[model samples]
Target: MKKYLPLLLVVALVLTIPGLNLDQVSAESVDDLNKQIKDLEKEQLELKEKQDGLESEKSETEKKIQENLNKQGTVKGEIESIDQQLDTTRANIQAKENEIAETNKEIDSLNNKIKELKEQIEELKEEIKKLQEKIEKREELLKDRLRTIQKNGGQMRYIEVLLGSSSFADFISRTAAVNIMMDQDKAIMETLKEDRITVETKKTEVEDNKTEVEDKKVEVEDKKVALESQKQELVALQGQLNNQMAEKETLMAELEHEHEELHEIELTLAEEQEVIRAEAEAKKKAIAMAERKKTELAQLNKKEPAANSGNPNGIFTHPAKARISSHFGMRYHPIFHENRLHAGVDFATSTGTPLLAPADGVVSKVGVVGGFGNAIFISHYINGQSYTTVSAHLSSMSVSPGQEVSEGQVIGATGNTGNSTGPHLHFEVHIGGYGNPVNPLPYLK
Candidate 1:
């Protein structure tokens, strides 16, 4: 009997050690899960910050691109105006050239007229010289004739012979003829004066023509100088226009390049933002699923307290006096239209339905929660087994966290709050705030 007792004690000790080992392993697993959750949360926060920065950059890039586009538009308008001005300047230059050409043609014609006038002046001078020579020779001949007449008149004293005989009648006729010759000499002198007057008038006409030619040459030279100056001005204006056009082209090119770059950047930012948004959405969904799973696990662990505790026979009361509208497990949701696990039981109840504590417990949490509205959580012990229960979708909570309450005490009121199709109570049970959900029906009945 003593030998058997030692063997039994050894077996019992071995069994206890395995249980202890299992407990330690469970604790380690929980710690690891907690670490993973914290790490994921930190990653989510960092991702959010990155997304924000990306969004800000995207907005700034878009603003820059818009500004560049506006500047480009303004530059294009200026370029158009410059083109118009250039065209106008070109037309004016052409017109000026035409004017200059016409002026040159007129100057050429005037030059020809001046050349003809010079020729006429030279011809008039030759004619004046020839007339002067002829006058000089005639004067010489008249002088010789006058001297012969004077000498012959002195012999006229022989007229005394004419008075002595009939021959004297012939001598008297000769004296009368000599008197006519003297009158002829006086008429010749008057004709010579008239000829000299005519030559002087021809000389005066030649001088006037020469003066007119000189005036014409001076006018043509002035016109040429004015046309040359106009051409120079036109050239300068053309150069200025060319420079302006070149500058405008460069500016336009720069703006276009900047705009294109900005557009590319904007596109990149947009794509990045899309990626960030997708990631954020995925993260949010994952987090929500994890939270739901955590709650479900806690509920399961609560119901299956025998798995961790020796006491297997324990019971808990219903959290509220309500009829079950929806059961746990997979069901098609009317709104979501997909197969989903109803993590908690849904109870159909009137608004302001009183929710009682299912067991003697201390309130662990009381606050408004997303998708649950006002909620209350209670921590309790049954046969040395710790458990937690939650009442969600409540209109109000009457107890504060850490407040003790007896079983059957009203802790909250049920209502249609947060993601509810109707007034109802969403109830859950948990053990150690972790582990899978267990069937609550076994405990309620």
Candidate 2:
């Protein structure tokens, strides 16, 4: 023992060196894990704050959307009311047009009657002219008779002439002559009186006809004017109703556009919330993993070095028993209709098909994750390197966050949820952590 004193000192010195001591290295690794946990916690807090803000924004957007719907209802009602008014106005206009048409017909009839009356008056005037010529002839005959009587006997009477008659035959003959002359005069006067009465009657009839026609025409004209005025009023009312309807329709369109925009904003905010939530969940998983590793380091004799420098093919296994439907790369998105990164591999399968874990991992997130729908995220450690696997668009989840799962363990059932086109599993491999998506085809067994 005395001869091995130097060797004992060398052994003690080797143990005392910090690089060779297992506990020291383990302590340093634990410190690093603690720092990682603290940093993850800080990031989680920030994510939580961001999630709260996104939620508030989403709530406000939903409120606005509801308000827009209410306003749209009101605008639609107003439009309906305007439509009713337009219908009524159109009916009224049609009725007014009918009235005007009837009035025009009446006026036309009255005008025709007035024309007939004018013709009748002209005929009466012709009769009056013939009667005037007859009266003139009678007057001339009477004047000639008076002139003859004055020339034959200036002061002699018929009675005195008869008394001076020489014989009875002469007296009889004179009486006969006087009787004949008187008869001729009486016939002439009778004819003159009848013509005057006839002329006066014709003049009165013509005047009466003219007065009746004029009255009827005036009344019909008044009715026509009134109808035309009413029609104009109705037309003006219809125009106003149409304008109101147009305004209401425009308002409805604007409201609908605004509603669509609000809905889009709500979706965007919801997506943001899901992103923040996923980030927070990722941070929590990191903390848990670091804590678990720190505890394991305290008990283990030595820590294993990272193998393969984070190579994927040696770490992961096939996640689902299905054929590959799509590979991770830039492709035209079926839903969004744009060229974008696929970000994952799609496994074609039927709905409710079990989704297996790609490796031994802890479930980091289990819920709706934006477009992923009922998705699950697993935090994996492969040969001391961090990795993450995502199982998205799930119909159901069997594992919850923070639950440990082994390789080939069922974590969920695949379905067509979120942005998927059909029932399939959208599986992603992130070599470092979340948000770093890589082609999972090369990594799968």
Which candidate wins on TM-score? 2
Per-residue alpha-carbon lDDT of model 1 for 269-377, expressed as tens digits? 5544443344333333333233324444356446644322333344556777767887768887442257856667888889898898876666655666545667786
What residue pairs clash in candidate 2, if any at all? none
- Cα deviation in Å at residue 1, candidate 2? 45
Model 2 clashing-pair count: 0
Name the best candidate (by lDDT).
Answer: 2
The C-alpha RMSD in Å for every predicted model, in order, reads 23.2, 12.7
As a TM-score, model 2 comes out at 0.51
Error of 1 at 363 (Å): 50
Q: Return the TM-score for each candidate structure.
A: 0.47, 0.51
Q: What number of clashing residue pairs does each candidate have, in the order they appear?
A: 9, 0
